[model samples]
Target chain A: MSTKRDKVIVCRCEDVTLHQVDEAIARGHRDLESLKRYTGFGTGFCQGKQCVALCARLLVERGGDPPTKPITPRPPIRPIALADLARLVDDGDGP
Target chain B: MTEELTQPFDAIPDACDVLVVGAGIMGLATAYNLARMGAGRIVIVDRSYLCSGASGRNGGGVRAQFSSETNIELMKRSLELCDDFATEMGINVWLRRDGYLFLARNAKRRAELEASVALQRSHGLPTRMIGPSEILSIVPEIDVSGIEAGSYNPDDAVVFPWPFVWGYARACQRLGVTVHPFVDAELEATGGAMSGALLRSQRVESLGQEKHIRAPLVILATGAWSPEVAAPLGLELPNHPHRHEICSTEPLKPFLGPLVADLESGLYFSQSMRGEIVGGVSNARVPPGVDQRSSLRFLGLYAKALTRTMPILGSVRVLRQWAGCYDLTPDGSPIIGRVDSLEGLILLCGFMGHGFMIAPIIGLLTARYLLKNEERELFHRWSLGRFERGELLPESMILG
Candidate 1:
């Protein structure tokens, strides 16, 4: 919990830093969902794969959670083109 | 962080003055206001965590631009309350009053908008009808090629929806009201009145064991899940939970002036505080449920509609897409106040897609009604009994 590690980037997809995550936690966003939202961590290009665990661990470090529960995972876990996804559904193919 | 916020939740009480079901914005707002007015021993229980329902899953658009007088007046007050929310609740909701620009793609829709704008203007709302050329100046980000006319209101705004739930719940908790999350409630009616509910924990330690709690008054803020609570009681509250979906693109330069909506397709988009172009389109083709999953159908519809309206956003990559339920009553308006025969059970639901927008004023008014028995005409007009009497003032300005 040193200030030296404060600026370390946790969510590369959104460029959310560890300091930002800790700050959100300190401001009463104890749950992973609110933390994910307030810090914009797990909602970036990686869709939480890169930063969810880090943020969850940080929540535990701040004495919060059943840390296993992360934010809700949505479709197309990897980034996909909007045109391509539209085409995929139009062609009768979907997840 | 304060000591009270991170502190562990207190145990559920066996009895309370008011039992509020669903800890979403409506319930929390109502509960917080009631507790503030010295309504004793308020307890709120939800099946999921905060922001887990329609309250959290909305576009957070608060506007007074509506065709009806009641809708316009309620939203006008809701906007002011939102302006003072941060100071009063001690949480920054990140409210941005960039305004809402509604576009009409054809002559028919343009005429409809013109009439609505006139109605809005008569109520002292600053809504103005504009041409496509003026629409370009409002939001150059949108391509106004097919747009015939537009409705521009500078007061309509957007906010980060999560903080409203958290702020209200925290305020309630600080006022000695226990706002329990991850807990389920089964409505219990005895003799005639509601006798509170049977609570069961949904967490790992204590799960599915019901505990009886007694209270004379119970409020159902259950939103789309009200049918389940109503069915066993033999009360016919007809509605369906339409799953509405939304998506956000990667952050870009913040250029969009207002939340833009296509009056024809019900397609709407706005730039978030973080600069992501977040948007959604109207879709009711799917089945109704609280746990409706996201579908490729939503992405397809939204992408086509959004791209067709704003060609510049065709290549913008979608970072996330999710779905939530819109609690649609038989009539478009919300069903508030009391239900007949169900003496102690009150209904504060069916606000449709604009519940989050109007919840603040409704919550304040609902709390006043409970405290002093003050009768709001909206409570009577928006009651479930109207459906039986054929007195439906169905609202027309609903969006996804």
Candidate 2:
């Protein structure tokens, strides 16, 4: 009984489905922050770059919360290796 | 216009028994326990959404490895509560009490840990001081070159900060306690006593959005912003805010068994249940004030510290970085309970960096003290009058 919406993966990083996001919306956990926490859509490796807009659209169109401010974007928009960041400076060579 | 808002304040009359300010864990947890004791008409108001304060922005480290007896005792009870948090709060906080390894860099630090472990053991904590080999056995990937020694306890824990806040907010709601976020409250005092607060919506201010409420008792649970909230009401608090930054890496197979901290550098990191390495470093270079902005210097400093501690993590990918203020006191100890200068108000702040960990026991004890009309000497010991009496409790093991 899997439909197209269920099959359509909204968040590639967390593997959140479009239907899953809609269900979280209907359960009163709307808004981008709560929706992100409830559905696990924005906390993955991609950090919501690909899925936040689609989830926001679903929230507003599906009788959830109105469109307010966008979710807060965290730093390191793209993943940075710890080794690369360590060499960010030669602060020292010891612990 | 404020009535259009979805807050359930209309169900609450203008007058109530207790009003808790700041919907963070301290306030939410205290209000939850009070409501469970059948204290009627409890309402909690927050200037922003839940988890927007220090409660939402902490490393979630819970440990009983303090140099002092009282702190160690309080945290021991909190760890017990954390063990039952998932079942009791109906929210999974992912608490793992695997252990906490405090690595000492120099002999002085080693001596400090040695003394702290001795005190912790005397007080029923199974903490022990270990050499470099045992340290290596614990974290196998750690670079123990500069490490002299360590003190470890198997019962220390870390948790996800968000669910701890959410769990208490949910528990309060199930007890008929209303929590309204995004509501800014301006506290009013009459004749040198806390009268109540004037509430307004932060999202939709102006346009006749003000509402006046009355309460006999109020709990000032605002952490870093306590000074700002208390200033207009004519109370000068000694606590100030120090911004701290923390970051997490992408998920991987969980290898680290416990949280590891370098005592000299103030660097602490623990692997989450989702496998991301969450950690932060104490940098004195961060300019003072209520700044939550992250900096490149912090990233560089933290990376250097992490790579120096564990060279193998150099290849790990960092996912995100965020910051929150630490509510600090002059003597490095938390000030709890009632203040002498402020009538009809109880103090629940100045927890410094470790408030998030010890809130469960404090909340329970606060309700027990208020509900049963009993007096705890611990509250009197931590009163604000001690600062004037020069009885400063200088705890030495405070870190990020």
Candidate 3:
């Protein structure tokens, strides 16, 4: 089932391919939201950081009903590791 | 790698009145409220620093004017909270009530704006439809070449995101709440109910050693990190973190006052107090997934869209360009309140991109829900379980 054409980039950060997302979609998951849960599209090092909009477009093209409304934007644009983040405050970064 | 939940430590004390996971604004805000209500021994553990999530990196637009009555009420109440936030929280939050101007360039969009304005006015929001001639008169800097009509809400405004987080964090600290940065919480569930959480932090300085925290009541305000945190517990939160690229141009003369959102190109911009035009454009390539790398294409798109909206901005040199991920939910509205299956896990996430503006109200609402079962229908409708019930929140006022 993991063929060349099926190898879509599910997550750009981790580079998990399309077969992952397609397999997830084929497994009773008819929506991009569910496909993301099964295929790990949004769960990545970047934390779905750059993949959501692309996934929306892909879902729309793949006949999966796109969200009637536009996707919402959450916080923490950059995913800084716990250690680096803690140090910022110690180094006077509370602003 | 973190180990899966296999055994609960018998020796370590594993209970807290309230355990706040993810030290973002919502978590901190809720924790502060819990602390105020005498929820003693409150501990807030974050896998990262405060505002290291979307709270710090957002457009920071606060307005009472919304297309829907529910959102308008929520924002109106939220605006009141934000107005006195500095004195209430004893932190100087640089909130400027510069007003928000949503400009429509076509007849259809103009009609939509008129309807939204009527809705806003019906709900006591100071908004009205203005002709292109009036639009030009209000903000003369904005070129009205292709603009047909626009919706102007003078009550919408912007603020610095950093201070707001600081306000909540300081308030929480003053209320005797313990905040541990860089501590990751490993959530465990039994029979579909969250039993407890195991928090591990190796950078503790108190004893110059590692530290661990255990709590029963945990709130997940991790924003984009919610999915990863939920994975260990076999729970799924359908929130996607999409990287949104934005930029700032060199400090120009003070020309624009209100936040300008072009409904056509998904471009939103406002001149910061420093005179730099700070805003972003919704790129066409951004799909529903995760990637936070910066791109030159975003800068180009912003320049083109800005020039199209206002011709005078065409010659302004860009100062810098950056990108951040927006933790988006399936529906546009935020997933606030408790996760039903989890005994103590409350979700204050999926604000999409509007968390900063609504943080004050969300903080109060999430806190009240935790303290008492009493809550508005808005919270009930926006629960994380709403998706499982096939109920989706439909919000139309989406900006870049």
Candidate 4:
């Protein structure tokens, strides 16, 4: 059985293990961003919406530096259906 | 975050002067520009919410040092817009023009950099080919042991991707452009010419049933997923979605000043204004598909590359890691223009990996083409039909 820390899944969709992240970190990747590239921790269908903040906090706990600013936000917080996105103007919801 | 039911309706219940498909950066930016132009009623639709595709997932590297003259010009114009984006759109976007530094290791790569420098210089871009000694002068922290030559363009930059999209969406809303989220748009045609679109899967309780949107001009700005949306319409686009991964480091004492791209390892790094070192490398070995699921293999590859490129980052902690998709075309150039044979149907797709950097200018140019049929010479050469006609724009600076 994997250890408690090892059992945690960094990438939920891909089922990447935390041990894998630790191993990569041991190989000179100590932070979240680089750890992400080395471990594929947050790249998923949710596009890191679910894990980016969590990862950020984890990195801080792991002795990572706190960012002077917040993480960069991309668009489409939710994956709205293509059909639903087309009715914005005519939906009778605007002021 | 406004509720849906309260929007305006009943005025024919459907139809408009223009209907833009795919609510990515291109579609949203184009819609906002059209409305700003005082064009007749415009409705922008999407297969998913804004940034569902490449727009939301890209690394947000806004650089004007493109190998292609056309792309360089387009990005130069777009960078100008991004410089004043927050004030212009009334939104705060972290637009940072920190500059891009492409590091060359081997003699062959150095020669290529020299050639690219000549092209960029000819186009009036502030780019120069420097040697290892000169590179150390710019980024003193970077370990240039194996590196020989480099290209530095201070004008190239980066920006936060989300606020840019929101800025455009808000601007479009203020200009009276209809913005719809979660509306799946289907191409509804008539005769040989494109007519209107049918928005499916609408979840409004007040409409009594699903809603429909019929517009005169239909624009497809769906980045990576564009081919699927255009397939049924018989419009063959060469855009395919490729997964590109990026990650961030725990904030640190700002060290890296410019975006560094190591041509040897395909690794690039930049320090965010927030002091977090953020960047990614080219994975030529990544499987070519739309699958966004992260993998352990990529992590291993990235670690090796970063360690080899700049050993100074060995002690830095990683804050987060994520993957994004790129709408890749045959020649690394975007196909922007009116579709063949389909009147009133325009395509602003196939930006490959450079769409986010040029969204602002592309929006204006595409709107100009659709509104006045005035095709700018810049984007005219990047038409969708160029592939079949054997005209391919090769951009060597493309990262993985």
Candidate 5:
């Protein structure tokens, strides 16, 4: 069921469909980063929290070797509130 | 023959006339321009895929409302290029020229905006200072209670970021410029001159395999990673990386038009063509480095700032949040032009966070300088030696 194209949303945040992932792979983007760039999968709001593993599996299934190196995840792993960021300034820890 | 062509490492040439490092927008644009000008044997190498750097990660805000003369001039040219990019490059970048609305909450900030608007008007940019009511007319959803004044430029635009990179890459490919992804390049310099680069394939698990690409001219467009790439060759660059985080809310019915930015809080956001509210706020606490980690603190701050400026955004669900590094210099302007200390090595990094907006003009200018020895006054103003000479051209209107 998970392998079904329309049923699976690889990146829920971006609403990237499984068919889109397959198409990206078919176009020679067999790696996580290239797939993310081409299909807008892992770069959404969650920043790959729900999609990286699914993308890796698709890459392997499409005759590509498993990614030996992990795709480097960009920061703010979890969503935080705006008030919390302003408090950093009050605490004198602002960037 | 087809198998050899498909092989990753085999596609990389042993030597080229010009070797460009970094496959981001800057590198690709420069390569594309060089190829168009009949520059021979150009090769572009990236440690990661194209647009993986700040090019792919920015909020895609392009504006001519700058505080400095040089930036305003450069961005004017860049805006024209972006306007014609779709027709010229055969790619629809989705250039939406709804305008940019910059808000000021206090007297001092309002004064700065007024001065900037005046300068912009003098330079023929259709930028003007507007009142609180005018701001509301532009963005009816904005809560302008604390806003003292504002500036608006209807010519400023928001573009789809990924296709801009892809369009340049495609054009480069058409011009016979070879681009190698997942290849790490180490500068091979001798006596303050670059001779070649030692390339390592990052795709396979080859323990000791390395390829050397000998070239006389090398352009460093590595963005945030510029310092680390230069350090191996004993070159010290003053540029540092500052992480800026952005979040996108779920798509909604389009209510906002202009990309609204609060001058005091460093919060800026715009709705994409597909309707996602994409924007971020700057934090003063993010330490300088290549750390692209997003913080819950940023999310919280962005939420508060967004709600404070535009209360309508409070109900939108933030679908995702991410971060990218801004190649920051002490003066806030970029480091461009040839490095006097390093012969055959050109520098094109340190754009703060506005590299994407200015890259089109820089690419053309850098290519012209390289191919025909055409030097512009802007290049001289942004040279690397300006730091040591203490002749800083600080830009006042920098936002995330």
Candidate 6:
């Protein structure tokens, strides 16, 4: 059997451990965004792609209400290169 | 004891001496400066939580190696402020000054690096041009075959971004500045002069109760949302949001010492304090907007680019991928100063991607400019009217 210190990472993007999520909840981070900000859970490169659902489940399992709403997702749902966007620059001469 | 000032709209005063529009680093730092300067009745409102914008999502690289005299000078002061930001803000920001190494793949880019190093050295920055062998010596893991030349500055650094934002928020609250998160504020213009903003709760229950807050001075520090915020007031800022994505790999024993950048591919990465390799590469086809979604294309591109530069990272597992908006400007320079079109409105947006690094100094300079009427050279060079005057100052050292 795995010991309690054996870290089970819930958010792979941020390397957030399940223990850390419990600690965040203990510290009163009830909502998804609050938990995210407190524990650096869903703010990684994947931007919570795999961790949001896991966090929601953890919240429910811990007797907390499911997050009132999923954390607000921002743009480019996937990582895009800056050079790719720079190539779309019109340089002001488009008719 | 610092009172909890992050209250809802109903608990806030209807008017203040200054109303800061965004809660990102720029807005928060500027409000902290204003409060420290004893500006009375200051209130800062954000549509999202603290550090939810570009300020929170950046790669946390701070460098003074720039191709322009203006940028180098500004970054020099900014670097000094960042060097002591932890002590100043009363928080450990995990600042690491290992250095930043920028590589060039072609002769044209090498020449650009050389010129930029010269300009940077002229401004007292210790940046210098180096060959591939020197680059290899600094970061032995990188593939030096294709690298023609490089520029490196030992003074450049990186910091954990979340603590920086939290530090500023805490300092602002301690200084008696009110910060309201989840509050939607819109600029209100009356008779071509500046007025106040209409505030409403972003929460579902109090959605309809709009509160009007009056202030003589309104500063727009909304990074990607700057244009949207100014559009209703008839101000057309040329700044647009370009999405940039970054990824982090699983922690490994630290080998990389400095943030490395490919000048051509716009790929930059640095090892974090916790041994995670964090960085991003620029894509050529992303559309302009605030879309911050991560993509598989970025992963493939980053994997290829990173391994090509440093082949050993190919086996590293990428743990997370995320995206943020860069408030791109037409001239590739930031717009900072009072707007001539709006009477009491000051413009402080269009930082491209380096807003986090420059926020500390900008906050100080902007406070001086607004409170003491200090005319700074940065304000003149990066004025909003420069774009209209056909005078553009484009910096060549921008990397993602």
**Which number leads on DockQ?**
2
Model 2 scores what on Cα lDDT?
A: 0.83
Interface RMSD of 5: 4.9
Candidate 1 on B267-367: residue-level lDDT in tens? 88898888888888877577746655787788887887777677787778888888788888887888999888888898988888889999899899999
**Backbone clash numbers for all candidates listed:** 1, 1, 37, 34, 16, 30
**How good is the docking of model 6, by CAPRI class?**
incorrect
Tens digits of per-residue lDDT, candidate 6, B156-224, equal: 999999888878887888888878777888899888787899998874434556889998899999999
Mind giving the per-residue lDDT tens digits that candidate 4 earns over B168-241?
Answer: 77677677776665567678777767778766644232233356776768888887778888888876777788
Return the lDDT, model 6, position B104. Answer: 88
Ten residues in sequence with the least summed lDDT for candidate 5 chain B: B1-10
Give the residue spans of candidate 3 off by over 4 A.
A1-95, B1-14, B202-212, B287-290
| DockQ (Cα-based) for each candidate | 0.42, 0.47, 0.02, 0.02, 0.30, 0.12
The interface RMSD values of the models, given in order, are 3.9, 5.0, 19.0, 22.5, 4.9, 8.4
Model 4 regions more than 4 Å off: A1-95, B1-13, B202-209
| Ranking according to DockQ, highest score first | 2, 1, 5, 6, 4, 3
* Whole-model lDDT, model 6: 0.82
Residues B284-362, candidate 5: write the lDDT tens digits. Answer: 7886689777777787777777877877666666767778899999989999988878899989999999999999999
Best candidate, TM-score-wise?
Answer: 2
Query: Could you estimate the TM-score for every candidate?
Result: 0.93, 0.94, 0.75, 0.77, 0.91, 0.87
Query: Model 6: how far is B371 from its true place, Å?
Result: 1.0
**lDDT tens readout by residue for model 2, B1-400:** 1111124334435877899999999998899899999888888988876777888779889999998888999999999999999999877898998899999999899999999999999989999999989988899999989889999998899998888887888788778788876677788888878889988765432323678889878888999989898888888999999999999999989899889998677889999998999999887877777888877767777888989999999999899898999999999888888767768888888997999999998899899888886557888778877899898887778776
Which scores better on TM-score, 2 or 6? Answer: 2
lDDT at B128, model 3: 84
Candidate 5, which segments miss by more than 4 Å at Cα? Answer: A1-19, A42-54, A69-95, B1-7, B205-208
Considering just the first chain, candidate 3 attains a TM-score of 0.62
Over 4 Å off in model 2, which ranges? Answer: A1-8, A26-28, A63-67, A92-95, B1-12, B204-208
Clashing residue pairs found in predicted model 1: B334-B350
